[model samples]
Target: MSERPVSTTDLDSYIADLRQLQARRRPAEIPDHVVYPAGEITIPAHVSHWAAQRPATTALTFEGTAFTYPELDDLHRRLAGWMADQGISRGDRVAVYLGNSPEFVIAFLAILRLGAVHVPVNPMFAPAELTHELRDAEPGLVLTNRALASTVEEVQPRLDSPVPVLIVEDGWADAIAHEPFTGDDGDLDALAALNYTGGTTGLPKGCQHTQRHMLYTAASATTATQLSAEPGFTSLCYLPIFWIAGEDLGILLPFVLGGTSVLMARWDAATTLDAIEAFGVSVMTGTVENYLELMARPDIGERDLSSLVDPQAVSFVRKMTPQVRADWAAAAPSSGTLRESSYGMTETHTIDCVPYGFAADDEDLLAEPVFCGLPVPGTDIAVVEFGTQTPLPLGEVGEIIVRSPSVTDGYWRNPEATADQLVDGWIHTGDNGRIDEQGLLHYLGRRKEMIKVKGMSVFPAEIEVLLAQHPLVESVAVVPTDDPDSGQRPVAFVLPAEGATVTAEELVSWSRENMATYKVPLVKVIGALPMTATGKVRKHELAEDAAALNR
Candidate 1:
């Protein structure tokens, strides 16, 4: 549906008009928490609370500038008013296509403030990739930075209806400089966010999460992490905000607790260290590769990391080795509570299984197989038979199925896929796991093939689809190979066209131009791809071959 476009002058004029009339609710009356007091929770409740209770407190710090709680609230709500003035209301989708910046957070808050669904589009996506998600989400408005606006412009002509794109200039000061939106609170049961994740079929499916689902996740995370309002928590937001896990920690968890998320322009080990010392950064969540880089730094030991506390970090893809843990303990000894973070996916809102109280020496971290701790509040975990609902014995390895209040009802607009992954309110997470005798969940690995490159989700099918588009490429099978730094790297086995002379470097160069750099595969010119009897590409065999070739 087409939406009314709004201008800065229009928003100001509308606010002046509203000043003459009275409304049912005022912004000051809104509560501080939307997560707690369970039944009465909304997406923007926490922002209102923090803005009222601790207006001057630093809510978010980026580069060298900081936005206090009230400052952030004022900007977001006014932006919401501007959107509302455009008749963009509940159920309308708004795409946030910016990087990890304050603009991303403000736009996200504004969308939810208007009861609109938040669609966090990946900033790394190319035109082909961007078109797929925009087509599916059907955003009425697209919020992007100046540098990325061209990508949106490129994809505009290809969409069913061209979305109105707002390129942020000077922190959207003029765009949001109006009276605040003191409209009604968000409906907890209504759709709030659409987190897009790549599937086995090669398309990114949106995981439709309601406001209540977000509330439950925030509540579970609060209890699990022991977050409180007394002394506000502060963490780094170097992680990609588009990803569900990153969004939870960076935006959801921090705001829900009235804490500050010091945002970095990008990941730099020295800068992360500087932030830790500079901002008294309390918690840290990152990859094993990130930890290695920090530990590898000779000056890391010299850095004052006393403020980095209660760090039960989440190291993804490759497991965090004991040596790495020992190194961190030795280097940053002040981080006493270092251990595994939580277990979750986009559909379940990440934080499904939380290692809440697990310490460094606890069996939770040193388990034989990887441990995902216990299920969060109002969530149940069952290890079922592979591809079936039959409950397996506690020790038997099976597919981990989760039934949680926080679980998404289904994928957005895809009933067939919803039926395949979600059954009877139980999310069939295609992960290999088992319940130990002590009732702790131990994760084995992925039953389905979803490769992770430096903690970024990279589907083999998506890579293969992109590679197959090459003119010289007859057929391609993408599989994961061992990577010391990135955990796992995609290795493509390409069957070239007859008499075609295409170098491996040419295919790699082509892939770099098409997809995200992390998703780009190391091209290998092969005579044929291993196939099943039905002529399907045998990915597992190709994976083994890739490992052998790497060795």
Candidate 2:
């Protein structure tokens, strides 16, 4: 697998080609419309429909085991019964503390089948972090693997309503008896799941989602993947299923749409590409970091990836130099159309997606900083003046506010935070972006100081506060520096006590010990960060300074 290098000119030429393609026919002029059937029911029905109609079709490919629709359905039924037998009644919360295995899928559907909320906890979460969500959700039953079972056991002593941890494989005999004998009949008003935010700041909060919402969103997302009518479309499911947005759109949507997925334990670039070729995957979606690493792989170009398709998001596109954007796109294996750019948070149920090949006039400028494209159907996107809640003009940048059916209701229990985020039915998406005349959205920056490092969200304020607690440190400021591999990496600027000397590696190690690996800064130093009149760190200046340091 030899690498294929594309030039800046070649990149620009392709953008020009894409512009010509867009100018030839407008999306509005195409006269195509999506029509959904009336009386769309809840999620359990959708799953049941697929199970009945395509019982023999491949439902999931996980760990070399290809589960047929019938097998998948039976697993869900047995799991549902198991939940009931374990005293998990309808409307109860069931936390699935497992990885991307058959058990995760079965556990999720089973919880929904019994009309209970399915809270999928991140398997990568530390015990303290897992305990927080456990306390918040207060699930009656938790499904865990052998590896995570101990974590649950350790945290059980600390939680108020510590529930029974059922090891899926080891406790199969005990769990099967609890299989939900009831069919796909349940209340739609019941909660579907409580998706917690990836807490870089404090404890993750529960995002309340219902069965109807998940079903509808899954249908729309299914269409978005272009898998509605396309049979045998292979999807790559690597991200943790705990994140409701990715699980629904990336995994479940494709399944319900009659598509296949090549499951992995986690993201391994080499393994991912090999699987793409091995399973004949057509569509792959992940953060920008994932793509960059895959592209940089030693033999990326030689891989038989003729089946690769749409990319949901790309990070480097937003920060790419004009030449680099074109270069990157041209370099992307032309097997699948990188047709869209999605800009959304987990809270909005992953709303605000924009398709590529829409804006012709701004193609040159647009290609430089990745444009998020236009809002999806049945969505209203607005760039409003900060703090005033007033809509901005066409090209003026402001806080992005979205109103849509996909928008989550609110944060669970945290009424104060919920009140702050949800105001007047408009979700204040903390991203900064502007819309062009043709309604294409271009991402500017984030409203808060949260930095998206690799695909992980890292808030500098969280790290700075933690480091400030150190005895040797007087002041600290963390700023994001660009990296070709990892979209962004944090570099800490510290003002130590007078003449104290601390190496960057030592500071980095110190941060690693105190926080999550992603939360720690990669680079650390001894110096005071530039500040303004109000004593706030001059972040923009620090960014420029970091750029110079890199040079």
Candidate 3:
């Protein structure tokens, strides 16, 4: 199987056909000036513009502490100045290893202001996981809080060279007292951030994004999600700031629109509800797990959630059902409707499809199990024959490919992987889907061996490699099993070493100790593994077996 050669004429026709589909499904016109030209403006420039125009407007609210636009801009500028004093310069990587706090936002802006690339590290990462990213990114400085300082220290020795660690709590107070940064704005094409995403074959790879990419994502997300562009437009942000979605909504969107974001250090149903009620949050985003947890809150019905307008969610953890949507609408009448569904990846910086403004009872949306709405403006999507890149006709299921200004430049330090994923300006998304006649994307499933647990990508190969290290394990096959609350959970079919005894509990426990919580699989011991004629484990059969176990 290989990609078929597509002629110039055929390609042009295919693109025109895609545009027609988009026109059919296009939502209302985006408000004027809501979406800025891509590659023309940087995020720091947005901040500066908003600060100059709406200096007194509240820009962020975290745990009762608020920062106005001017104050927030000044803090980031001062932090950028402090970072420069520490020898950081253009193109240097600076890792932000903090959770969803005000410090994370400050650090993010500071890095971008100084023309340095931001490296967002998951605060939940264990030492081994953190070490991999540090070694790969080789950041000049790591910014973390006191709580997670030990995690950074533990991984410091593993790096090829010693990197400086700046504790957020200890450094912020003094940094804010220094003179603000008066440096030149970073070039639009210069690298802005290195977002790490899990690979199908190995450890996570960093997606290299530039200022243009980030600005484009923020603009498209703002317009596509239908966020209010007015000042005082409040949003609840409990999502991790380290992730692309979190960065877009919690930091970029609010700044771009001169709005206020109420941040939570971590998600707790009670706390989230309280913040929503107290701040009159108008917009928010979350995964299925977060929504489920909020719905499960006993006092959910009594809360005043009338402030919510356009809440968005991804259904990777579980399919969004009519009942769930109804329940959500009932809980927040002002929300006017259930959360709009969208599709994106780290490679795209967050958003690709925007379903906002689509009727809740649209027949096409109801019929398609994975109906992610039309591509946002300045973005194009197509379904092509796998391997060959030949354009498939409308309604034909094939590999979903994307061409957008927001797509990552490529993977950092992995030219081979970059070549495989990015080709001729189109990102070869491993996802399989078809563009229906109505212009909506109907997701089939992944074309690769990957599992999404609680909206986080988990690869079987990564887990298999870790479990193989167990002394009593001889062979292992990891497959995704259906999960109601989480989209899918990993299940391990294990073959114990000859004459060795290992209980499922023991292996599960070992996995908990060695891997991230989301990567640990439900272990099932098997006497022998199903194999193909070529001597490879039959993962499809294992997936079926795992599904059967659920029944």
User: Is candidate 1 or 2 superior in lDDT?
Assistant: 1
Q: How would you encode candidate 3's per-residue C-alpha lDDT over 1-551 as one tens digit per residue? A: 11435454666688887787677667656542336632256787777777888888788888889998888888989999999999999999999998888888888888998999999999888777788899999999999989889988887788999899899778778977779889976667898899998877778899999988887777777776666566667878887889888887788777767778899887787888898888888888777667878888888888888878777666765656777787777766666466555687899987888767665575434766677777877888888888756788888999988889989889999988888888777888899999877767877888888888887779998788778879999999999998876768999999999999999999999988667798889999999999999999888888888987655
So what's the TM-score on candidate 2? Answer: 0.79
Which residue pairs overlap in candidate 2's backbone? 1-299, 80-180, 81-178, 81-179, 81-180, 82-178, 82-179, 354-374
Q: How far in Å is the alpha carbon of 32 misplaced in model 2?
A: 7.4
Residue 384, candidate 2: C-alpha displacement in angstroms: 1.0
In order, the Cα lDDT scores of the candidates are 0.78, 0.67, 0.81
Winner on lDDT (1 vs 3): 3
Residue ranges of candidate 3 with Cα displaced over 4 Å = 1-8, 31-34, 37-39, 288-304, 468-475, 484-487, 493-507, 524-530, 544-551
For residues 1-551, write the lDDT of model 2, one tens digit per residue.
11212233543453344334433333543212232322366655655666677776677888788877667767778878867777887779989888888778877778888888888887766655677789999999888888878888888898986698888769866665554466665566667788887433445678887766665565555443344535666778787777765586446665656667677778898888788888788777666556657767778767777777655444542432334334435565556544334667777777455454443444634553457664555556676766545666667888777766667778888877677667666677777887665556677777677767666777776667667767778888778787665667777788886778777777777776555566677654746668899987787877876665545
Candidate 2 residue spans exceeding 4 A from truth = 1-39, 177-180, 183-185, 198-201, 287-306, 311-313, 316-334, 359-365, 461-485, 490-515, 521-551
* Ten contiguous residues with the weakest lDDT in model 1: 18-27
Q: CA shift at 70, candidate 3, in angstroms?
A: 1.1
After superposition on all C-alphas, the RMSD of every candidate to the true structure, in Å, is 11.4, 9.0, 3.0
- Model 1 Cα lDDT, one tens digit per residue, 1-551: 11212233543453333322212111233222333632345757778888888887899899998999898888888999888877689999999998898888888888887889999999998877888899999988888988888888898898998888778874477778867898976677889889998877877889999877877787776764556555557878788888787787778777877888888867899999999888888877877667778888999878888877666556665566676678788977876556777888889998887655544466566776677766665667777777666666667898888877889978899988888888767788999998766566788988777887877889887887778888888888888898876788889999998889888999989988778888988888988877899999877777777887666
> Better model by TM-score, 1 or 3?
3
